[model samples]
Target: QPQNVIEKIVQRYAVNLPTPSHKVAQGDFVSIQPEHVMTHDNTAAVMSKFQSIGAARFNNPQQAVFTLDHDVQNKSEKNLTKYRSIAAFAQSHGVDFYPAGRGIGHQILIEEGYAFPYVMTVASDSHSNMYGGIGALGTPIVRTDAAAIWATGRTWWQIPPVANVKLLNTLPEGVTGKDIIVALCGLFNNDEVLNTAIEFTGKEGIAALSVDERLTIANMTTEWGALAGVFPVDEVTIKWLRDRAVYLARTQNRKHERINDERIQDLVRNPLLSDSDANYAKHLTLDLATLTPHVSGPNSVKHATPLTTLEQQRIKINKAYLLSCVNSRASDLRAAANVLKGRKVADGVEFYIAAASSEVQKDVEKSGDWDTLLRAGARPLPAGCGPCIGLGVGLLQDGEVGISATNRNSKGRMGAPTAQAYLSSPAVVAASAVSGYICGPQSLHPTNPISKTFAAFHAHPQSPIITYTDNATQTPPAKSAPADVIPGFDGTLRGEILFCDADNLNTDGIYPGKYTYQDDMSPERMAQVAMENYDPGFTKVAKKVRVNDILISGFNFGTGSSREQAATALLYAGFRAVLAGSFSETFKRNAINNGLIVLEAPQLVSDLRKAFKGGEEVLTRRTGWDATVDLVGGSVGVGERRYKVPPVGRAAQELIVEGGLENWVKNRIAA
Candidate 1:
């Protein structure tokens, strides 16, 4: 069937994009100056690098922004210090700062009127991709890259490889993009397609999702290894962008063209279908009818079978949660409520709901959606990111397991380092809330599918908080007397390794401080928070180990949020090396980009765990620790065929000795 509705979406970008091919493909770098650039408090790391590189003044400070959306109202002075540091620097840099009143970076950006259709954008946060809804290419950059652009308004991207996610059949009325993504995750087992650009199309997509719903799905595409997931520009998208004052102001430039209109027309006239002969390392198809509502966990997301198969697993869950960008919309909230309306939650089951925006919360409350949730014993927390960030409400207890709509559930990410949280969609979360165990939407019927939303929560074209600023103090990059700092990490000489053989430990488990960290923190202030996952802080134990002291783990290590703080925690904690049987594709790149040595050996993972004697000598040569890991076999290899663990990319290797992105910039500037 022709995706008549989708043709409209496809036509928009395909036409507006004069050089779509430039934006497509790997190794071929693409360069396009952004209409706007945005950053967060954590982005301070990059700002420092920009300064080191002799960066001063933005092309237009009014267009660039900084905010303290994370770790606001620091609980401890240490955390408070982090915010103060960033705040001080932003003020001096003349970068706009959105006060605490604004929410996350993307939210505040739209609310403040920064995102506009047919424009280009880059952010320090991965979820920046959410901007694609308004018809802009909002993607993340490494701190160093952001700094370079911050100083020069010039940065480069390897034109990304493109994949067409063709949606075939009509979606069931109750279904959503959240459900589709969860199902898609089950199709791709590993991150073999990381850093590629994904474009969704096909007959079933038209009218199947609102632009906001599409934004919610695209927001999480980072987890899928996409550089950006885009849709063609359309009248609906242009309307959304036109609503913003900042957008209107930006377009006031005489040079600005109504590119959106022609692009929309172009897309309709000559669609950019996936090349008939375009080679794809992966091509997958799904039957919307055959997809059952599901939650992934107790194993790989690819292991997500069906809700019916859940009871067979009998994995009892302590809580069921739905919210986050994954499934936080009126439709999602309505779907969950539809299941629990007159029913009482099961014994031993705790249910919680979080709204992505207060706008969604208001809609839910106005319609008495809150009543349904409250009656069903589901707690509705503040609109700010909750367990989706692992900082506050809805965290899992140690040894406890819960089902959630958020992406990536690594060890202790939600709460207790020992606790396991499962990832699924709103329908699955809602159903499991009643069942109090791992199960699917079919287990409850009528509510077997989930609905997703994001951009729509704010129906109005304007948001009150428009910049990433508060008071005018410019915070500097954290600096303490080199001696004043306690040596959380002192490189050891083949020191004894402190090994835990758990596989797939998500970054959430390593840092588990997204909310806390974002609440207004300086890296130093938030430094101790990294160890909060373990009693008395894991750093204490980590510090006892020597340089080259290996921290060995099971398969798929570092599987959660893309925050560099996770690696920061491990690096500061005195460990010098990461030896895992297999690495999550993102974490592997992240570690190398940050200068951490990460080696893989899958079979040896179990043996290494058993071989660990606290402070046990871990010789690089003795353990066969030198190489790439065969993720499946636990074997290590080297050179071009190093399947077990390939050599780090050249650009990544350059980053290693330079300390981090900023330090690297400092050297580049000094030189």
Candidate 2:
């Protein structure tokens, strides 16, 4: 049971445990502790529905949380309606709703006492697994689970077979958490072990990373089809948490009550580690000493290759972006800024910087390091799911190229369908910003980099003024921006109903099985499930393969799960776009990231009831736009229209072609 011994033991006993099944029901199942179960503004829409259906309090409010980090600055009545209502819901139901400006969800969760070691958690959002930094299990759940959890605090889940990641030594210079994960994406991408648990241990783990760095690797577990990620939270973790508490007490709300210390004294004051005898489904040690700057993605996150493996001379980066819950830590920002401190961004490349937490942003701004980045030609943007999501900066245009600090670089994820994205660390993003192509962190950032935390992010570029919506009334979908129009194609339209319609949909609804073990992203298999999962009739209605389909909705559509696979499933189903009454922030961004159009169609539900006559051709405002239908009765739309519905920039369009960052890197290497 010693740390080194666990690896060999797990390897020998792997076959005895559940040998990587996508789905399993445990009769003698141990109650795997919930790592996390979260909801944010996005999932609040579904909660509204749950309430309407006569659902009252959640079974266990302590297990639930709500964060208003998004759209919080707007004092508008509509925004306030949604934000305030969710807050009220949390207050009424005894759930936690972190105040706006508290920073992103996962960051706050760790700072405010939620995530810890040896626990399993699922969220309505994808990145919830970030808690793995503290050795917790984190997973993204679909809308089906969302509803069930909304009514009842618990939902069913099969304990994922574990994947042991053995770390043998310290990380190499300029190599980091980002490289480790991207490398794994390439190394363990086969279907044999998808949707597994990844546990890291060894002297290598002890030496290489800080708790924050571990979170970076943990955040992207979803891309690996992981149920959650875990690392032993040691003294280092406990210290960071306590220091953070002090940091927050002084810098944030001075009056804010510290986490109830008495109740969590052991966790905050002295956290424990996983026993050497701990069980694992699988174990694979990584030689962190050998790791180097690597990049991933021209298509799936699985498309990973070493920096040396890539044909760097042929690659051109149109954009260099730094953002994400993972790498946006202050250490990363300073590393990136230091690299670009005196250098200008490449001539043709657009540069962007995004921080994950407002505190981190404040730290950077207070130090004025942010000014160094801006002076270096990188446009400083507020922290949110930036280029990582389609809504913010670094949007890849069709055939455009980009380098980013995000966790996943899945195809079209930056924006443009043909665009390509490369995933790397902050130092790598900085290096790429200077060189105008994918480059290693060492090329720009040096060893023992200097970092500046505790600056004023809000006062500088001014991160988005988070506006809270006090009410969760369905925001009727409407074209929030003008879209681009393309000439109609000569191909036959797939089905009479270009899309389908429904109310209160989530990404999980669009793609039911993303978290399943197979981790299948195949076009045929995914399209097969698109509408079928919701309404069996969707399979046939979506069958007309030649034409684009559209799906319309009534209200609060696409409410749960940040899985881009949701949009991918719809795209593969021959749907061009999603025309909905409203979309959850994450799902809406996922639509744009995958190159599918998601436009506001408040009027579609009314006019389309009769207009959806089976014989009618459902062409929309955007030609490439596609959608699908739920036979039980619903419609969907995808693709661009006259309105620029939360779009990615020209640079981002270039990254989408490879389907994501890993594939982009692979393609870059091949070329």
- Writing each residue's lDDT as its tens digit, candidate 1 over 355-434 gives 75555677788888778988988987655456766776667887888888776665666778778777776766776788
lDDT for each residue of candidate 2 in 425-463, tens digit (9 for 90 to 100): 787678778877776544443432422211111112211
Please, what's the RMSD in Å of model 2?
18.7
Stretches of candidate 1 exceeding 4 Å from the true structure: 1-25, 47-56, 72-74, 84-96, 108-118, 132-135, 234-282, 311-314, 344-347, 439-671
Clashes of 1: 47
TM-score of every prediction relative to native:
0.61, 0.61
